[model samples]
Target: MWSPWRIVGESLLSVAFGLLGAGLAALDHGGTVRIAAAGLAIAALSLLRRTLPASVLLVTAVGSVLFGGLAPLVLVAAWSAGRRIDGVGRAVGTFALAYVLNLGMAVVQALPHLSLPRLVFGVLWPLVAIIVPGLAGRYRSQHHTLTDTLREYEAQQQRERAMIAGQARARERQRIAQDMHDSLGHQLVLISVHAGALEVDRELTGRQREAVGVLREASVAAMHELREVVQVMRDSTEAPHEDRTTPGVAAAAAAAAEDTTALSRGVAGIEGLVGTSRSVGAAVKLRHSGEPCPLPPTADHAAYRIVQEGLTNAHKHAPGAPITVELRYEPDSLVVEVANGPATRTTDNGRGVVSGGQGLTGLGERTRLIGGLAHAGPTADGGFRLAGVLPYTSPEGGIPSPEPGNVTTTFVDPTNTFWQQTPGDSLDEGAPVMNGNGLKELAKAMSRKNGSGIAIGCGMAVLISLLLVIAALGVGGYFLLNKAEEARIEPKQYDTVKVGQPEAEIRKQLPKENSFVTDGLETDAPPVPKGAKCLSLTSTESSNNPDMEPVFRFCFKDGKLTEKKSFEVRN
Candidate 1:
């Protein structure tokens, strides 16, 4: 390629050569005329290149040969032509002739007596100078130009590739708009109808009623925004204005500027979410372990929609399983997790839920725009999980819209009273029919009853036995002196029955004076029955229940009471 740079360089040299030629013609000297003629010839030679093919370079080289061998431009042209000429033999042959002509002229000019040779010498030497070395320079210049041209061509190819890829992206966005119109547009219309019906129909079941209202609002909003996007694509306008006439997403956004209702229209209360799922027979639980809080309005709306979409998928796909929603707050990040166990029913439509099959992807995009991230997929244990992380910095360096209406949150009191039966929740077979509150109360009641029963049993058993022992000791002591005579005669036999025998038996050995036994139902004491027999004690009871009835039914057999009894609470 002949660049402007090359043109400028050659043009400057031509102008200089032309000026030199004119100046030399003004001087009155033979050498000056010769030199001036050479300069003019060189300048004209440079001009020929602009109009002729590169082959004209050979003609320029001839001019250099006729002028001085110092003509650099001629040398460059000769060399360029030589390199471009493909056959090596032709290049060498042509260059060799130019060398001989100029060499012969130089040889003649040097021989002072040889006039013929002198004339020949001047002409031939110049020819030689412009051809041989000129040819070498032309070859070098041609190689350099070719390398530079190839580099520029490569750069151009890369630019074209990038342009094509950009065009492809624009085309894909158009295609995506078309797909959304076909699928999401219709589904949202159905959803709005069902939802609108639920709002006015008092006879609708609660679950259906709640679901339809949310679905209706969400569908209408989604359809409106979708249509807006489609319209933008259809029109191919750069600076886009959203259409806000519809009661859909775009419209709600426009309304939220001055209305709180608009903000909550497509939003589900986070608290009611779990309850709704439970009402539909799903065993669901919700727990938030953090500062009691909420999010900015835009983030709230975006996140709530994501959660709604996720749960709707769970219900649509894994309808029978229990779900757990956990919201954990870290110092720098807010995490939302929705996990559901596998479904047991055959009707589960466990597939992608959105019409575009890009709802989650859209959620992710929304998250990114707000400096957040969202992750969603099926879990390994026949379940699904959706997670999102909303960051603090938004994409456009702005905060998400503030939430409308302050939250009036309530904290749970630990000691709140409760019941033995919960109206609804997880069912237990043998477990007490209670919530956490009932379990606490029942525990306290059982503890009280057990302590009382233990105290009564221990108190009664020990006291009666101690009284009998003391009476026997007293009677036996009185008999001890009398028994001294008996012991002297029967020492070994008395010792055998002393330590290991029952106290009742020991009491019987008290000469029948201190021995007392109770019989069933007929003790003489008012509280004790008479018939069978009775032992009366005048000592006050040490037990707290001093009004207790005496245990009258103790039967004795072979010097031991075989049956014993205690007071009964009722009659």
Candidate 2:
């Protein structure tokens, strides 16, 4: 779309017309013809948008005005540049360049019209043009910087999240390796050591020797595989690749895929895992217990890994054990279960091989990562059993598929985890709720147990607030009782006072006891008897309670003392 030849042609045309206009404007002592030519050049330059850029457009617009090239060109160039680019960087760059060029030209043009006041407006107006866009461009620059900073911060957060995830995965793998070495390594050593001693005994028959040899081979293979895994982990990135087998669930799954990146093949690829076990003298039979259904991606991965690890452990620990793996697909999840019986006596191995016991732990980690559950341990009836339940997500991305038209909606308890349910199990409410979110529920249960202390403290605080409120109410009640007792005049005089009388007039109506030798009982002597008031009763008689000191009381007209009979005893 952007042709170099077309761009060159546009530039040459623009330069030619601009020079021609300059010649006409110089010869005619004016610029009417030049203005017309510049307008024509601008129109042609605009037509070359996809091919040519603002180089031609700038020149074309400026040449259109003889002495006033500054304003016309800057304005037109800004308008043209807006339609040229989408990015802020380019737009600001174009605007800034135009501002500088326009302001400089304006100064040159105004030099000839130099009067003190005229030059001021001339320079100031052009400064406005230059500064306005420059200020706008500054804001654009700061805003662009902020956007870039935010994007960088987001990318940094993603990297940190990935790093934390990787670290957690690595730690899990290390723990798995340690468990394998500790538990399963000792078993394999016993098999190898006892078999080597039995091989030396002369009482062994030929068939017995062959079985022992197979046992030794299987044990050594498992030990070496475990060793290779440990070495690979010791310095993960640089470990030798010569003995690399399927490292984890993901690698095993990928090795079994025709195209590992594609999600369609799924658990079907686990046949490859079965083939690996059969080579190691283990017979692994894969079967389906229930009618299979379309499985969610999480269910698919969990099913594959559970079966693969079960078979792997069978081959490593119980070489001649007949292992059976059953998978069942349900509406909400997929269930995978693997069981192996005790070693058979057909070939009569000296001792069964047993490697590190990380198979079960690794399987558990894989299940938990995708909201699934896994269990693996020795079975009550001889060999071992492995089970996992993987919850499904809707392909539409949010909710699960609705119950089928023919099917009744049933809820299952999460903790009731079963790879395949028995025919006797009635689909009921919350039966599987415990097992489905067992890990999460375990954490919540612990938190609830721990928060009992905080709950007690909260109860204590509430109790203290209640006690304070009761104490404050008791204090208020005592104050109210004192006020009522002080206001006990004769019952007939209780309603005598009107409500609207002033406190000063009520005080004057009460009696007081005073030994008025000179002026008044007030501490401050006034020009007049300012503190004096006529009283219906003496202050001493008004204080009827002997326990109370003599105090002033202000009485109402009929006889009620409207003011308190409280003491003014000075120390």
Steric collisions counted per model: 21, 20
Quote the positional error of residue 134 for candidate 1 in Å. 4.9
Residue 302 alpha-carbon offset, candidate 1, angstroms? 7.7
Q: Give the per-residue lDDT digits (tens) of candidate 1, residues 343-404.
A: 76532123222343445655564554455778998899979998888653443332233222
Highest-TM-score candidate: 2
> What TM value does model 2 have?
0.32
Off by over 4 Å in 2: 1-222, 234-287, 296-304, 314-324, 341-354, 369-371, 380-383, 391-571
The C-alpha local distance difference test score for the whole of candidate 2 amounts to: 0.49
Q: Which prediction has the highest lDDT against the true structure?
A: 2
Q: What local lDDT does model 2 show for residue 195?
A: 59
* Poorest stretch of ten by lDDT in candidate 1: 242-251
- Any runs in candidate 1 off by more than 4 Å, and if so which? 1-105, 112-308, 318-334, 341-356, 360-375, 379-383, 389-571
Superposed Cα RMSD, model 2: 33.5
